[model samples]
Target: MRESLGDFAIGRLDAEEAATVQAHLDGCADCRAELAEVSSVLGPLSTVDAARLGDAPVPSPDLGDRIVAAARAEGRAAERGRSTPRRLTLAAAAAVALLVGGAGGYAAGAYDGIPREPVAVQAMEPGVEVSAVAIPHTWGVEIVLDGDGFASGATYRMVVESKDGREVGAGEFIGTGESKMVCNMNSSVLRGDAEGFKVVDTSGATVLRGDLTAT
Candidate 1:
């Protein structure tokens, strides 16, 4: 049940599995606490720049051994019915270290085989400046955006339009209106089928548009 908390936090579990997890969490105080901790870690990790991960410092050679040791210690504590918080913390730390050490491989697999392509972003309204990059994957496309000059506290949606005039919702982000805004959005629409990308406000007004054909 504890092992499934990570997947449950990210909504990766199937309906039945998720329901079971939810039911268990409703009664398990320890698992609920651990789930909150894991969720906090995942939220920031999701925004990590994968392109820069290649430059991350290599971990110590013994990192893998340390992680395995931590896991074994955690299992031993569980079997003994001892307080597991210390062992759990150690295990979590080891897992995070492993992810940092293997970030290069993770980035390579995440982007698939397609090279990152710069999309030409055109401002749809005055005083708006935005830029985007399109990364195509086997499953679909990921858009990386960096910009400013949006309505603060407003929600913006990314819409990907196919060549046939069909539109697919990519993802959404909140605007800060000040400072640079960075967001990563994904869509199930294949890159080859997408003709353009549009960032629109909640009112359906376009703020920025990008041409995928030239990407």
Candidate 2:
């Protein structure tokens, strides 16, 4: 995973580390997008200055269990067919989430928390869009969302829930001069049993629903 927090704006890390990365971000758009992605799922992370940099993010309850179970399922499925790319993507995602939790809070709404307005989800574009594909030896869980055509600098929000009534990743998305987002979650509830995952808006409406995939 990209260990450089060059673009990360708000997080639970200390000053020295945050500064090193922020300096890099001032010139990297990719990092800016990443920082945006993190804030999108979290909240107005821009509110985070270099002053308050070192704080641990609170991971939602049972996220690890949910992730492990999903990973096992993906491993079994991958045994039937190889998918190294998917596994790698998940590894990166898992590592990133772990890092975020180490310093930030599981406080999604704090940064990108959406308004009370209902969400209108666009379809996930193929080829150009990001998708959480099949995972090989997948030992974690993820929630991904993406779309196109937006009003620029738009912020999208998501409230995910496993069938067990536990919130997975309650976050928002900052659009990339367009109306699309991708929130990949590898949470605590994935270690054991979970029926499925569903995405929602601030009003508690369903946007997407399906079983946990391999990657």
Candidate 3:
């Protein structure tokens, strides 16, 4: 029959849909004839009885050798396939756009010959800036932001805090240009078992934070 009913032909519809299709099939002799033809072609096979299917075909006595040869041939083919490899960009093109934007920070005279530390701008929209904090016993914290366009040079700082209050300990470690930085806490920071953590920058400002859950 000119049909490929898939799971539908088995009368396996759950409820409402089953009733509808069953009704249609019952009234449709053409569909029934197609099913019959399929059944005839199948003969005793029916639903592909595994019991009567018999053992799988045995290979020739030299099967092991043949298999090894085939594997070698395949490996050679794979080696050849691997040969035509393409080079990747030093940084993803998008990174260039982000670096210009703020994903990596910039200095007042970053574009000039003046040397300065680069700031990591969040790679996400609306770029993040440091604000204030009130946590406790946190040591060092590093971070990577999500967004594009970071400044080339400039140190992003954290909001300052005292030894008491909510500010027990806190800080961050920043690299020149990175999507992620580390956070060293004064205490074991359990960021709700998150994928990442957050932190403040050098000047005691909220510089980095994001994605905390799982990889």
Q: What is the C-alpha RMSD of each candidate to the true structure, in Å?
A: 20.9, 22.3, 17.7
lDDT per prediction?
A: 0.82, 0.49, 0.42
Using Cα atoms with residue i matched to residue i, what is each candidate's TM-score against the true structure?
A: 0.49, 0.29, 0.27
Error in Å for residue 76 of model 1: 18
Residue-level lDDT of model 3, residues 71-94, one tens digit each, is 999999878766434223434556
| Candidate of highest TM-score | 1
Lowest lDDT 10-mer window, candidate 3? 130-139
Where does model 1 exceed 4 Å of error?
A: 1-114
Model 3: how far is 68 from its true place, Å?
Answer: 0.8
Q: Which stretches in model 2 have alpha-carbon errors above 4 Å? A: 1-131, 134-140, 149-154, 176-182, 213-215
Clashes of 2: 44
CA lDDT, candidate 1, residue 128 = 72
- Candidate number with the higher TM-score (1 or 2): 1
Report the poorest 10 consecutive residues by lDDT, candidate 2.
109-118
